[model samples]
Target: MSTVFLALQTNEDTRPIIEAILQDNPGAVVDEQPAMVKINADGRLVVRRETIEELIGRDYDLQELQVNMITMSGNLDQTDDEITLFWKS
Candidate 1:
């Protein structure tokens, strides 16, 4: 399976976002760097707005993720409710 990854700046704002990603994506591996956190999963990864909202106890806009996002891999599909990354094959 192809691996998909999402890297984001490490900060208070992203702490809940990272938690949401882990809750939504099972088997995802997290790698922490100096100022960044990278999560890798085989084949696919997903980020959900509802999950983030639940974690942070407030509404969340999926676009807000762009603020802390550093980079990512895989084909991207985004919607008002969620963002998904996956390999075509």
Candidate 2:
């Protein structure tokens, strides 16, 4: 399996919600940075694209979910948990 890295831009206050999403997704890690969050899950790292839509349906700020810039790299090992994440504000 290869390693995947992803980054997201968001408010500091939503760290917990972001963390929860990552936690629910095993082998997934969430990193909080100033006005941004980085997520590494399995071998595919990226802000939950669908998550944004889902939240928006609930009346969340769509603009807030808009990523200034998002990057995703590597492949994932579908059968196991093999990923780590690091983030700092």
Candidate 3:
């Protein structure tokens, strides 16, 4: 399977967001860099608003992810509830 990745800035706001991604995507691997965190998965990665709200104990908007997003790989599908990345094939 092809790998997919999402990279975000490392900071107080993104910490819970990163945790939510890991909880939602099994087998996802996290790589921590000096100022960023990269998450890699075999074929897909998902970020859910509910999971982020649960982690941080407040409501969250999925679009807020764009603030910390550095880069990503895969076809993207985004909705009010979640953002998903995966290979088309």
Candidate 4:
């Protein structure tokens, strides 16, 4: 059990995409913040810098997964999992 703080733009479709990702990886919990989504999961925690880029890779335009910022903070260990996210809506 590890905690991963994900900061990304929000949209109606984004939720489903995130859900699918979480589903793929069990033991992952998704929490919604003001304008961010917190994902606490197990296994190797990967901080993909180009998450949004790869998410909407070569689609209509580079605007679908327009992630203004992506950062991970707080403890990221299997033993203790906790994350805090800050964003504006």
Q: TM-score of every model?
A: 0.98, 0.45, 0.97, 0.45
Those runs of model 2 whose alpha carbons end farther than 4 Å from true positions after fitting are 12-24, 45-51, 58-66, 75-89
lDDT of each: 0.97, 0.50, 0.96, 0.46
Q: Candidate 2: global Cα-lDDT?
A: 0.50
How well does candidate 2 score on lDDT at residue 65? 37
TM-score of 1: 0.98
The candidate that achieves the highest lDDT relative to the unseen native structure: 1
CA displacement after TM-score superposition, residue 34 of candidate 2 (Å): 1.7
Model 3 clashes, total count: 0
Q: Is candidate 2 or candidate 3 better by TM-score?
A: 3
RMSD of each: 0.5, 8.7, 0.6, 9.5
